[model samples]
Target: MFSKILIANRGEIACRVIRTARKLGVRTVAVYSDADAHALHVEMADEAVHIGPSPVGESYLRGDKIIAAALATGAEAIHPGYGFLSENPDFVDQVVAAGLTFIGPSATSIRAMGLKDAAKRLMEKAGVPVVPGYHGEAQEIVLLASKAREIGYPVLIKARAGGGGKGMRKVEHPDDFSEALSGARREAKAAFGDDRVLVEKYVDKPRHIEVQVFGDNFGNAVHLYERDCSAQRRHQKVIEEAPAPGMTPELRKAMTDAAVKAAKAISYSGAGTIEFIVDASQGLKPDRFWFMEMNTRLQVEHPVTEMVTGTDLVEWQLRVASGEKLPKTQAEITLSGHAFEARIYAEDAAKGFLPATGTLYHLKFPDTVPEGATMRVETGVRAGDAISPYYDPMIAKLVVHAKDRPLALQALVAALRQTEVAGSTVNAAFLAALAADPDFSKGDVDTGLIGRHQQALTEIAPPNADIVAAAALAASGAGALPPSNDPWSSLAGYQHFHPAARRTRLHYGEHDITAKVSVRPDGRFAVTLDEPYGSTNAHDLRAAPRLARWPGHVTVFSGAVGYTFAVPDPLARADESAASSGSLRAPMPGLVKLVRVTPGETVTKGQPLLILEAMKMEHTIAAPHDGVIAEIATEGAQVTDGTVLVRFAEDVHA
Candidate 1:
């Protein structure tokens, strides 16, 4: 094995690679941008180097800088952890040219599957099923529209160089095809610097099932079963699992076979994933699955495959890259149990799951593997670490393994509830609710499930009144009072020296909860409050001194009623006009990549006018109405959330 290697990435993936490298006694080097100088990945590596500024183009995407760092650190190999430069064929070639081993597929294989168009052609040649689409390299808009027409309505406009959902759109009718294509092309240009696109038939109720394939230079390859990545928001996968729900033995065998064939055809080496969009309308058949795109590196959801196959893929990557033969064959691999992985992101699910940034004040996960919960939290962040916008907002990955899917789902929900993450707008409660969802538990999930149940998923999860009262009483700086207290110190009503009941108001979103807390003669709290369900008694507090430190909690006391209420922070909000408008605005902090329209340009509703690169993905600022551009406030400039980019002028008509 190589003595030392450079990880050409940052964040959790970089740390993940470092851990594996350490186990092999390989010294590791980490490259970071200016913004990540103190990042966890940097601190974890044996040595660290500063590449460039925070912008990925100047740092992570700079192949020469990364290569120099590797060479300077005397790294014998380089591992391009997914995203950034992982699938960039040119970068792989440069790394190999630098006289160091690239710990992944050869530059040739990456190129074969680098572009969606070429990859589809290659898959077809290998006899692997591919989506029926027009991937021809034709740039004429009219011709592309004709191809969409040929493919049928409800066609998808996707960037030939697409991943993470950027530069993709689903058009339901011919009339919407032109606008969608234009938007997708512009986004593709801004994101990948390639305006070329492809038209594909949209499969309804599509479930994303991808097979993990590994190979060695000796032309040997094996499939590590499959993972279902259908649960997504905005086309970005949020949850993933292995041994797909409802996947029969026959279907698994067929999918695995197709994946192996694709790998063998490419003479693929190292780790790669062959993703398929399985059509559920006609049931999962060998013929019903179509190739989506190939991820030419270790996937973010690789943990699920690891749990089921009982193998560490990173170890295999290192072994193969070091001129070793395949460690195992297709027949040797086996699946043991079901697994689920939810990508817990530092995002506001209530605000359309928009990326959020904050310090992770207190992060704790259950230590014990519960009755039904087998928890594995892989993270590089700590309590004091900040979720910066210069990178992906992923806080941690919570994976669970159980004997069956039901057990896994049940365990996952309970585990999420037990997770306590403070100081950020994490989607823990939302993820917990999703696990408890009846449809999700029964395996009725899709790409649109979150969107459909968005309201319920984002309803701010607040502690019960009793819990709030307990916290409040503790925060009141009052340890359990003595049974008998002096009249001056006692907060109870007396005959002559009577103390009126104290009321503390706490805000929970829009409503204020007032807790009438008073000390009883027996040294316990009594709390009374009116909830939506009418007047109720809530006094769930244990007599403990530690409870007295809850600063913002509201302790309530009524006749034999006592409870603790948590105070919600009103400062945590996206500052913007509450009223809806037809103008386009920036949804987060990002650099404007492009502005497609000029003043007086006519735009239909949902037309993309500009693109923003933030949190490691491209987001388009869309037009909300069919009108001419009134003004443009931003063009290739940095902006924050709610910063208006463009407004539409009233439409002119005959």
Candidate 2:
């Protein structure tokens, strides 16, 4: 095996590669940008080199800098762990030219599958099933729309150049094809510098099932079964599993064989994934599956695959890159159990799943998560680490495995509930909802699972009455309401005139809850409420009511959550309008990359007029619609909380 290798990536993927390299006794080098100087991956690697500034354009995307760092560190091979420069053929060629091995597919192979149109054509020739659509080099708007009409409505326009759901659009009608095509092309150019797109048949009920394929230099390749990545949001994968939900033995064999064929046809070596979109409306048949694309490096959800196969794919990548054959034969690799992986991202699930960034005050997974039972956590960031907006917002990946699909899902749900992350909004509750969903539990998996019940899935976890009462008691900082005469003392629960009941309001999003506390004789107050989720009563008026506190501290509540109200000399007050709406805000900290309109431009409802790039993905902020843009508040600025993007016209004025 090669003595050393360089991981041409950062964050979790870099750490993932280093782990396997360490297990194989191979030294690993990590390259990082300025923003990730103290990142977890940098601290874990044997060696780390600072490549450039924080922005990807200046650092991670700079092939020359990465190559130089690899050579300086004396790495014998380079592993492009997805993203950045992974699929860029020039980087692979340059690494090979520098007398170092590229631990992935050959540059020629990548070039063949780099473009969507070209890859589809190649797959068709390789005897792999392909989606029926236009792959011709026609860029005219009229022609493309006509072609969409010819192919029937609901054709997909996808950027021929990039993945990650960027530069992809689904047109549902002949009328909207032209506008959607232009937008897809624009995004494609911005993301991959390739405006070319491939139009394909949009499967109504598509299940994304991809096979894990491994190969050696001797043209020998084997498939490691398949992963069902049907649960998705905004074209990005959120949850994935191995063996699929409704897989037959015959269908599994056929899919695996086709994946192996695609890999061998290109003389593919090392680790790669051949993704297929299956038309489940007709039930999974050998003919119903179509080639989607090939990921040329290790996938993010690879741990679940590892759990089922009892093999380490990264170790295989190193072994194959070092001129050794794959450790397992086609028959030797077998799926033993079902596995699942939920991608835990630092994002607001309720608010369109926009990537969020914050200091992780505490981040911990469940210790009860089974070891041999298949629950695993693969993450790089730890407690106290600040989640930066310069890259992906994924904080960790929670993987679970079981003897059967039902058991695996049960394990997954328990793990998600036990997993707790403080100081930022996460998708934990949403993932839990998915794990416990009856439809999901049953084999009704598809890419549309998220969209089908988006509201219910992303719904915020309402504060339980017990928890709310606990927060109130913690906020008061006393076991009971201190007597007004001796308010500074800790023991007073009730005083003169029926215990001086006070009213405090809580505001969560657009909803409001009012709690009226009547200090009781037993140091516990009865709290009655008119809450958005309905009224309830909560108790426990002790100094520290319930043990929900973290670290060495307990939180007295504040605002809607309860701010600890210490029994000091005096207190403050609030008004009726304090619960009303403030200005429309940015919601999170990020860079305002583009402003699509000026202050006076009139726009229709849902018209996107601003773009923000945060958490490694671009987000377009739109006008709510049918109004004039007044007080447009952003333009390529680094904004923080409450940075208004645009205001409504005069009618919206309060």
Candidate 3:
């Protein structure tokens, strides 16, 4: 095995690689941008090197800088962990030219599967079943529209060059094809620098099942079963599981065999995934599955595979890159138990899953579970780390395993309930709702599951009296006071004849609540909350509430949902101008990619006015109502959160 290797990535994947390298007694080097200088991965590596500024164009994407850092640190090889340069064929060639081992598939193999249209053609020639669509080289709009009509309605336009749900769109009819194509091409060009796309027949009821395959220098390969990533939104996998539910032995054999065949067809080396889009309108069958695409590196969902198969894929990558043969034949790798992985992202599910950026003042995960189950949290951020707009807003990947699928799912739900976070909006509650969903628990899932039930899933219930009382106590510091011998020290609520009530003001969501507290001799609090409906609710607590109080905020976790309250400053003035202004502000810090309207242009409600690109996704700023644009931010401008992007004419009526 190589003595030392450099991880050419950041975030949890980098930290994940470093852990495995350390286990195998291989020292690891980490490369970081200015944004990740104090990141968890950097602190875990044996040596660290600063590459460039925070922007990816200047740092993580600079192949020369990464290569130089690896060479300077004397790393024998480089591991591109799943993103950035992982699937870039040119970067692979550059690494080889630098005389350093690239710990992944050969450049030829990557090129064979880099472009979707070309990859589909290659698969067809290799006798691998492919989805019926237009894989031709023609890029004319009229021709593409004709092909969509030929393939039938509801076709999917996918970028040939990238993955992760970027540059992808589903058109339901010919009338919407042109607009969807424009959006897809623009996003594709911005994401992959390739606007070319391919039209494919959209499976009505699809289940994304991908097989994990590995190959070695000696021309041997094996498949590690499969993962069902059907729980998704906008074609992005939300929760993934191994040993797909209702998968028969015959179906498994057929899928795994085809996966191994695809890997060996290109003389593939190291770790790769063959993703298949399964048509589950019927059920799991050998003929109903077709090749979607192949990920040419280690996957983000590899941990679930590891839990079921009892193998370390990273260790396999290192050994194979060192010219070793396949670790085990197909029979030696046996599936044991069931596993599930839930991706926790720093996003607000209620607000259309918008990405959130802030400091994580409180972050906690379940460290202990039941005896028969195991819980693992793969994260790169700590309690005090900041989630910036420069990178993916993924907080962590929470994985759980048990003896059976039902128990494993139970453990997953429990783990999510036990997890807590603060200082930013998160999707933990949404994940919990999905995991505990009736159809999901019964394994009746498809790519459209989340979409079909999004409104119900994203709806957050109002906090009960206990929760509000907890926040009020935290805000007032009434439950956290030190014991005093003198009764006068706690006389705030005391009266000559009877106990008096002291009121504390606190802010929750959008309303300011006044909480009345009366202390008891037993150290309990009689709390009364003034409800919004001109009524009062009271609760007498038995003990101190479970919560975390920061300088200006307090977070209370109730099951899987966390409620954060702002402890307003007593002497600070209130500013509500932004809330009442007729302006559209950027929701997150990002680059202004396009200004769709000029000043004084009229737009209708929900019309696209501008595009803000952040965290590798484009968000279109839309008109809130019929109005005339008075002013607009310039295109190609870097903007922070809440920066005004478009202002409406005050004289114009909606």
Candidate 4:
């Protein structure tokens, strides 16, 4: 193996590669942009180099800068972790030209599988079953629409150049085909710089099962097994598991054989994944599965595969790149147990899964595990790290393993419940709900599971009296006081007549609440909450809810849910009336991609007015109610969070 290698990526994947390299006594170099100067990956690497500015185009996407950094650091090879330059064929050629080993497949192999349409055609020639679709080169709108009609209604338009649910759309009818195609093309161009798309038949009940395959330069390849990524939202994988549920021996053999065939067809070397879209309306059968696309690098969910198979894929990549033969034959690699991986992202599931950006005031994960189970957290962030708009908002990946699927899933749910985060919104509760979902527990999952039950899954119960009292105690600084030995200090609130009480004001959601707190002689707290409904609830507690206090906010974690309350300043003026104003503000910092409605144009509630691109995704700003647009932000405008994008005109009477 090479003595040193350069990781040409950022975030958890980069950090993950570094850990494996360290295990083999290989020195690792990390490259970072301005946004990630003090990132955890940088701190963990043996050496670090600054590439460019924070934007991807200026830094992570700059192949020349990355190559230069690798050469300067004397790195013998470059490891492109997952995203950014990982799948770019040109970058692979550049790395080879620089006389540095690229720890992945060759440029020819990537090119063969880069474009979805071309890859599908190649698979068909190789005798691998592919989805029936329009894989032709024609780009005209009329021709594409005709092809969609030929394929039948409810077709999917997917970008030929990329994956991860970007630049993809599903059209239910001919009437919506044009609009969907336009949106897909625009997003594709923005994401992959290629607007070319292919029309495919949409499977009603689809399960995304991808086989993990590895190949060596000696023309030897083997399958590690499969992962089921059916639990998804917005066409992105949310939870993934290895040794797919209900996978029969015959079905597994067929899928793995086909996957190995696809890999060897291109003389593929290193790690790659062959993703198949399974038509599960029936059941798992050999003929019901079709090739969707190929990912030419290590996958984000590779940990689940590693946990179950007891192998390190990164070490395999290193050994293969060093001109080693296959470490073990197909039979030597054995599957032992089940594993599940849940991706924790800095997003708000309550508000349509909007990406959130903020400093992490407090961050934590489960430190204890149940017997016969193992828990691992793969993350590149620390407690004080900031989640900015310049990169993906993924927080971490929580992986759990056990002897069986039921115990593994039980451990996963418990781990999620113990995880805590503050300063920004997260989807912990949503993930916990998804893991504990009845259908999910029963293994009845498909790509449409999250979409079908989104409303119920995103529902979070309001804080009960106990949670409110905890927050009130934290906000009042009463929870931080130490136990007193003196009777005078403990009896300070004792009065000659009635007990002394202090009121604290806090804001929860949209309502302002007043908490009346009184200190008892027994060192307990008596809290009375005044509700907006003209009701009062009282609670006496010896212990406060588990909470973390920041400057102006306190977060109380109850099970998988976290309730954050704002400590209001008593001297500040009240401005709650503006909550009803008909103004649409940007939820996060992003660039305005398109403006669909002009000033003075009438729009109904939920009508798309503009689109904001942020965190590598597009968010559509819609009208809050039926009204006439009075003021609006223009296209190509860079906006920050809370920036008003559109305002409605006041109603006038003649």
Candidate 5:
């Protein structure tokens, strides 16, 4: 094995690579930008190198800087961990030119599968089952639309380049085709610099099952079963599981064999995934699976595969890169128990899953069930790290494995509920709810599952009276005894004849709950709702509420959800009328990518008015009912959160 390897990525994947390298007794080097100067990965590595500024173009995407840093630090190889430059063929070529090993597939293999259209053509020629779609070179709008029509209605327009659901649109009718095409093309161009798209028939109730395949330089390849990543939101996989729930012996064999064939077709080496879209409308049949795309790098959901197969994928990558033969032959590998992985992201599930940025005040996960494979918390951030907008907002990947699918799923739900995060918005509660969902629990899952049940998944209900009382008690320091030697200071709410109730108010997202506390003789306290926001009575405190209090904010994890309350100052009052100026503010900090309307331009309700690009996604700002744009922000301007992007001529309510 190589003595030293440089990880050419950031966040969890980089930290993940470092852990494996350390296990192999290999010294690892980490490269960071300005945003990740004090990142967890940097602290974990044997040596750290500062490449450039925070912007990816200046730092992570600069192949030259990365190569130079690797050479300067005497790293014998570079591990491009999944994102930034993982699939960039040019970067792989440059690393090889520098006389260092690239711990992944060859540049030729990457180029072969770089474009979706070209890859589909190659898969077809290789005798691999491929979805019937337009994989031609035509880029004309008219030609593409004609191809969509020929493919039939409800077609999917996808960017030929890039992944992560960007530059992809699903049109259910012919009338919406043109607008969907234009939007997909625009996003594709912005994301990948390639507006070329391929039209494909949209499969109904498709289950995303991807086989984990590995190859060595000796032309040996093997499969590690499969992972069902059907639970998704916005085309992104939210929950993934190994040994697909409804998979049969014949179907698994067929799919795994096809995956190995696909990998061998490109002479693939190292760790790669061959993703297949399975038509589950009827059931899992051998003929129902078709090639979707091949990710030419280690996948984010590889842990579940590792847990089920008892194989270390990163170790395989390193061994193959070191010119070692395949670890095990196809016949030698065996599948064991089922496993599941849930991606924990710092995003708000209610507000359209918008990526959130904040400092993590606390982070915790639950332990696995007894005699089960330990629940793993794969993350890159610590308690005090800042989640910046310069990169992906993923907080961690929670993986659980058990004897059966039901047990594994039960563990997943428990782990999600026990996982706690504060100082930022998260989808933890949503994840728990999804795991416990009747449809999901029965394994009737697909890419459209989240969308079909979006309201239930994203709906944020106010905290109950008990939860509010808990927050109030924690915030007021009523439950815990005072940290003082003097008895008088500790005598809070204690009266000579009777204990007096102390009132404290807390606000949770516009709803106010006032908690009244009565201290007991033994320092224990009873808190009741002085003003209940929800239609429920607040009972007396059973025990001290579990809480984490930061300045101005208190996060209390009650039941399945964690509720955050703002400890408002009793002396300060706000002017509601002054805060209601008619303006459309940027929901988050981002660059104004487009201004679709000019000042005084009349726009109907729900009309696209402008676009903001942030966290690698485009958010459209639409007109609020019938209104005329009185003021417009310039395109390409960098705006902070709540910066007015557009102002209306008259009051919106008026």
Candidate 6:
């Protein structure tokens, strides 16, 4: 094995690679940008180097800088951990030219699968079943539209380069094909610098199943079963599981054999994933699955495969890169228990899954169970770390394993419920709700599952009475009250002569909760809540509730969700009012990609007003109601969250 290696990435994947390298007694070097100077992965590495500025283009994407850092640190090899430079064939060639081992597939293998259209043609030559689509080289808009017409309506426009649901769109009709193509090309250009796209027939009830394949220089390859990545949002995988819930042995064997065949055909070395789109409207079948694309690096959900197969894919990568033979033959590998991995992201599900940035004040994962011994958390962040907008907003990947699919799923739900994350907007509640979803629990999953159940999953239910009480206890001085010799000072709301009540007010979104708390004569506390579900309650002053406070915010983990209440200062609340101004504010901090309205242009409700690109996704801000634009922000402007993007006439209501 190599003595030292450089992790050419950031976030959890970097940390993940570091862990496996350290176990092999290999020293690891971490590269970071300005935004991640104090990042968790940097602190965990044996040595760290500052590459460039915060923006990924200036740092992570700078292959020259990364190569220099690796050479300077005397790293024998470089591990491109999934995202930035993982699939860059040019980068792989550069690493090889620098005389450093690239801990992944060769440049030829990467190139074979770099462009979707070309990869499809390549797969077809290798006798691998590929989706029926327009894989031709023509990029003209009219040609693409005609191809969509030939395929049928509801065709998918996918970027020729890059993966992870970027630069992809689904058009439901011929009329929408032009607009979808334009959007797809623009996103493709912005994301992958390749505006070319391929039009493919959209599969009905598609289920994403990918086979994990590994190879060595000795021309040996094997498959590690498969992962069902059907539960998705916005075409991105959300929750993934190993040994697909309803996958039969025959289907699994067929898919794995095909995946291995693809790997051997390219003389693929190291770890790679062969993703297939399965037509599951009927059920899993050998002939119903078709090749989607090949990811030429370690996957984000590799842990699920590791849990079920008892294999460390990173370890396999290191061994193979070191010129070792395949760890195990196809017949030697065996599947064990089932596993699930839920990606926890720092996003607000209530606000359309908008990416959020904040310090993680309180972070906790579920305790490991005896039967779920393989349960683990893969993360590169801690409680004090900030989720920066310069990178992916993923918080962590929660993985669990059990004897069967049902047990594994149950454990996953329990773990998601027990997880606590504060000091930022998270999708914890949404994940918990999804875990308990009746349809999900039954394994009736597909790409459209989340979109179909979006309302229930994103609903922000009001806090119950217990949550209010917990917020009241934390907001009041009771929890932090110091011990005093004087009886009046010892108790909260104590009086010298007459009884008095201390009022505590807290804000949860738009609602205000006021609690009238007073110390009874016997030293017990009497609490009364105002408005809505008004009720009188009693509590002992000796116990403190489980709560976390960060400046103006207090969070209480009630039920499966953590409720955060904003503690507005009484002095500041006086100046606040519900100002019904005719303004449309930016929902999140992002770059104004396009401004569609002018000073006097009239727009109807739901009309395209502007577009803001943030967290690697484009959000189109629509007209709230019929209005005449009086002012508008400029295109290409960087705006903060809540910044007014458009101002309308006084007569218009937003």
Over the stretch 1-654, how does candidate 4's per-residue lDDT look in tens digits? Answer: 999999999999999999999999999999999999999999999999999999999999999999999999999999999989999999999999999999999999999999999999999988889988898999999999999999998999999999999999999999999989988998888889999999999999999999999999999999999999999988899899998998988889989999999999999999999999999898898889999999999999999999999999999999999999988899899998999999999899988899899899999999976789999999999899999899989999999999989999998999999999998899999999999999999898999999989999999988877788888877876556654543345434556655567688888898788887666556555677876323222234433467789878999998788899999877888676555366888999999999999999999999999999887678889887899988899999999999989878873221
Candidate 1 has a TM-score of: 0.85
The per-prediction CA RMSD against the true structure, in angstroms, equals: 5.8, 4.8, 2.2, 2.3, 2.5, 2.3
Position 382, candidate 5: lDDT: 87
- Model 3, span 160-243: residue lDDT tens: 998988899999999999989988898899888999999999999999999999999998999999999999876778899998
Evaluate all candidate structures by whole-model CA lDDT and list the values in order: 0.79, 0.78, 0.89, 0.90, 0.86, 0.87
Cα deviation of 513, candidate 3, in Å: 1.4
Q: On a 0 to 1 TM-score scale, where does candidate 2 land against the true structure? A: 0.87
TM-score of every model? 0.85, 0.87, 0.96, 0.96, 0.95, 0.96
| Candidate 5 Cα errors over 4 Å, as ranges | 368-373, 482-502, 520-522, 533-539, 542-544, 570-578, 651-654
Candidate 5 lDDT tens digits, 549-647: 877789988645779999888788886654536678887778898889999899999999988988768888998778788888899998887788888
Ranking by TM-score, best first? 4, 6, 3, 5, 2, 1
Candidate 1 structure lDDT:
0.79
Two-way TM-score contest, 2 vs 6, winner = 6
- Estimate the overall C-alpha local distance difference test score of candidate 2: 0.78
Q: Residue 194 lDDT in model 5?
A: 86
Q: List candidate 3 stretches off by more than 4 Å.
A: 482-502, 532-544, 576-579, 651-654
Give a tens-digit lDDT track for model 2, residues 485-598: 333242344465456655655444455546666554554455666653333334433333323333322333221122221222224454544331323568787778778888
> What lDDT tens digits, residue by residue, belong to model 6 across residues 1-654?
999999999999999999999999999999999999999999999999999999899999999999999999999999999989999999999999999999999999999989989988988998999998998998888899999999988899999999888889999998998888877887888889898999899998999999999999988889999999998888887799998889988888889998999998899999999999999999888899999999999999999999999999999999999988988998888999899899999888887788888899899888755464458999999989988878889999999898888888888878887788898888878887887889889888889899999999989678767667767766776646543345486454556674567788898887888897666555555577877756544454233455788878899875458899988787774533435466888877888987878889989999998888886778889988997888889999998878888888863443
Candidate with the larger TM-score of 4 and 5: 4
lDDT of 1 by residue, 52-156 (tens): 998888999999999999999899999999888888889988988889999999889988988999999999998888999998988798998899888888888
Which of candidates 3 and 5 is the stronger one according to TM-score?
A: 3
Question: Over 4 Å off in model 2, which ranges?
Answer: 370-372, 476-507, 511-583, 589-597, 602-608, 611-620, 625-627, 633-641, 649-654
